[model samples]
Target: MALLKEASNLKLITFAAIQERTENFSYGELDASNKPPPIQVKHLNNDRITGSAAQKFCLFRLFPIIFSDMVEHLKSFKIYLILREMLDIILALPQRKSWLPYLETLSINFQCMMLELLPDKATPKVHYATEYTKIIEENGPPLRYWCMRYEGAHLYFKKIAMQSYNFKNIPKTLAQRQQLRQCFLMSKCRFLKSYQEASGNKIIYMHEIDSKVKVLLNHRYGSQFIQSQTLLQCSQLIHNHVIYKQHAVYVYDLEHVEEIPVFFQIIHILKLNQEWIFVVDLLNTDGFSTKLWSYRVSSYDRLDIVSPNNIKYYHKGLDLYKVDHFHVVNLTSRLTKTN
Candidate 1:
């Protein structure tokens, strides 16, 4: 019984969703019986910063509020802008086609004229990057503004946890740890897939078609035929779309799957135009295979590894790509490009 109490005391479980709905529930669960000290869990809802109390305490973190209000309310507060690649933003939204239209309105009306339009007409263009940069510049160096890709949140959070809490809990059980790792990795992939489907990208990524074909080819003609088929299909897609001429192609592989050389060939063909193509493979059993693949393909120019359990710190960027367990490769240069 004493050993059971100690084990239960050491065991900690955290659920971010429940906390988001109501922190009271988290507190209630913690105070229920005092059998084991409850895990310290924080939901870190992105919306909380936009609420009224945040405006009083941490006004700079509020979203959808005016820059003037932010400047006026908090004279010297640290501001951070979490940005995602335009393609991933589209893929992550509920209505992908509506993204451009919504951005156009926000850029022209909210960000440009209403927010930054000075008495003179010398203001910079209202593109997303320009406006965001202007705000930071005018406001002074953000306490610590980081331009982060959504896929890289996992690594960022891991760093944050280690720095903040000195957490050194790396799972020991290979199979159990692998499952937990997959949960972390697949969470992002699943989010992006769902976002893409919801946003109306009938064809999520150009390579998805080829990837599907590769699966079929393996079953029908055996694995020996994969190389030729991958190359042929890649060439076909490149020729079909003018965009492929300018953009680089990336081929990602799972870490445990031993087909690095074949994927490298595919990456070579896709990056033939001197465009940036990234090939990522998760070598660890931590369930990052799907997410690493999605991170490789998602429109974000960079890849991040994040644990799903620590998703709150990365919600702004992470939540932007809520798709299913699938690969994503964003081909667009900006987050607001339409069609």
Candidate 2:
């Protein structure tokens, strides 16, 4: 309390509130849809966060979820919102050319906001924001040249070098450790995987499946014998190291801009014919709720079977949040380049 009072010039009260919210923020394990492992970034505001770039990026993406309920009227908080828009632009894969102007506008707005609101705190990072659109224009999307993987790869050697206490032939020691680690990891099933794979333990008889899904499958297979077979289905399916669970929402269509961000909820995860099939219920996007930073959706009874490989956009799915008797999806980014 004393320290916070002494730092009144920093608006520590708001900072403390956000820190408390972040510390208490919780989500289910199935909620991992490109979500980074949980990290306590409260200390990061004052002290350096000792983690990889991926971890930082993860926390950064979750900022909207954490600070969504904060005072929106705050001048500085608007800067955070602008930065989030920039993040969405930067992190996108197959970055579109149309987004460059919007990115430049956001970057300029971010810099001006920082200078106008917190004059003394304007840093070089803010200035760097201006050059993003220019660089992106010349070299194409900056994500094409991202070095996050390279940065992450260095962390392993750093840990080994700092902890081994072996100064002699340091390069050789790192090489030996790297070889052993890679060898062990590569020996495992699906390590550095390039193929689609799925596993689940729950078993259910086909006759016991939902009447609607059973009917749909039977019609597709041109027989009623599907009811005679058994199914190995689970509430959650681990596909290529990513978790896809029943009831989680995923992007199923990204072709048409009108329906570009279509989503479907996995009503069931089934394995048949040596392939993973998701029995899903397509969801219609109602609208976006900025207050929650999620998309409001309405579920339809129409059921369809889709292979994970068939998904056109980002494969990682978003868990639904029930707000005001409706389901909402917190997608990391928009496919529309103008966003």
Candidate 3:
């Protein structure tokens, strides 16, 4: 199916009867007003098969042919990454109760790929394979979320300084751009009329959280939390509550010297030592590409939410950069927690 699709797109012609070759086989002779004639062939079998035979034929024969061609074109590096990440996700499959055999098979495939990619003894990346396996065994594959932001940090600096072309005053030009950009970002916090306008006024109350639920609010807003049976003094409320089962939120993220706002989903409400807290999962942005389908909070992972009031919005998307007011719920059903 993939071959047929690619062949159709690429306009590949298979000639069955043309055995003769001439010097005049140029665009003038072969081209018939850009419309190539189709080759006809006789079929061997016309009998239709159903049930298991049909399914086996479709699954083993049809899909394999499609994926085989697709896989053939992929670069070695790309193929390696795909295989590695696939094994990583499999290792991190939350419910690995009866999945030991499957995990072993995937691990074998990953090991085989590693050998193919790094056959020599002097390769540095070969060392990562050991670390990768160890990390997966310890932390259930960390999946793609483990290092996506750290990897993405490399690009942020590149994007910020890509336009610096001053040969004589390269340092001065970069410093000036960085300063101006940061100052402009900080200025947005003082006047959040733009942020408020972009992110609507729909709100969610803290009372919605069950009394037994754990909350983890940021230390910045620790003083605002007042003890009360029915109502709290802080009155935790989030915007656009009705649109999401989980609230889309912004919080301060430390990126180098500047603390910019990052978008995330509030997955759980928690409390420790009388401090109201929110357990948030990070969202993938243009700056960072992640394979996380949704944010799942497990007992193993702890994230302290920053005060929403202290969040400073970036000027790129007016209020929300990368995310719009459009509602998108995280894949919470697939979320799993380990004891």
How would you encode candidate 1's per-residue C-alpha lDDT over 1-339 as one tens digit per residue? 111122223442124422332222221111222222211232122222222321222222112121211222321111112222222332331223434544343344433332442323233543454443344434432323433333244554555555555335543333354577679988767544412111111222336544543454346446454444233212212221111211223222223233121111122123212222322222222222211222322333222222112211111111112224333231211222112
TM-scores across all candidates? 0.19, 0.77, 0.30
Residue 308, candidate 2: alpha-carbon lDDT: 74
Clashing pairs counted in every model: 25, 0, 12
Task: Give the alpha carbon lDDT tens digit for every residue of 175-278 in model 2.
Answer: 99999998888787575664654445677876687899888777766553354578777667666566787777887666456535778988888777766788
lDDT of each: 0.28, 0.69, 0.37
Query: How do the candidates rank by lDDT, highest first?
Result: 2, 3, 1
lDDT tens digits, residues 1-339, model 3?
Answer: 222233334544222221111112222211223222221222102122222322322222222222332333433334333443444344343544444455455556655665664454224653454455445565664544555456456455566567554568766776787689789977867444422111222334456744333244423345443342232222233322211213334433434332222456555433334433445556543332122221222122335454334444321111111112222222211123333
Q: Which scores greater on lDDT, model 1 or model 3?
A: 3
C-alpha positional error of residue 177 in candidate 1 after TM-score superposition, expressed in Å: 12
Off by over 4 Å in 1: 1-92, 96-99, 114-126, 129-339
* Superposition error at 186 for model 2 (Å): 7.0
- Candidate 2 displacement at residue 108 in angstroms: 1.1
Mark the regions of model 2 whose C-alpha exceeds 4 Å error after superposition.
1-20, 28-52, 158-170, 180-194, 222-229, 234-247, 255-260, 323-326, 336-339
Candidate 3, residue 134: lDDT: 48
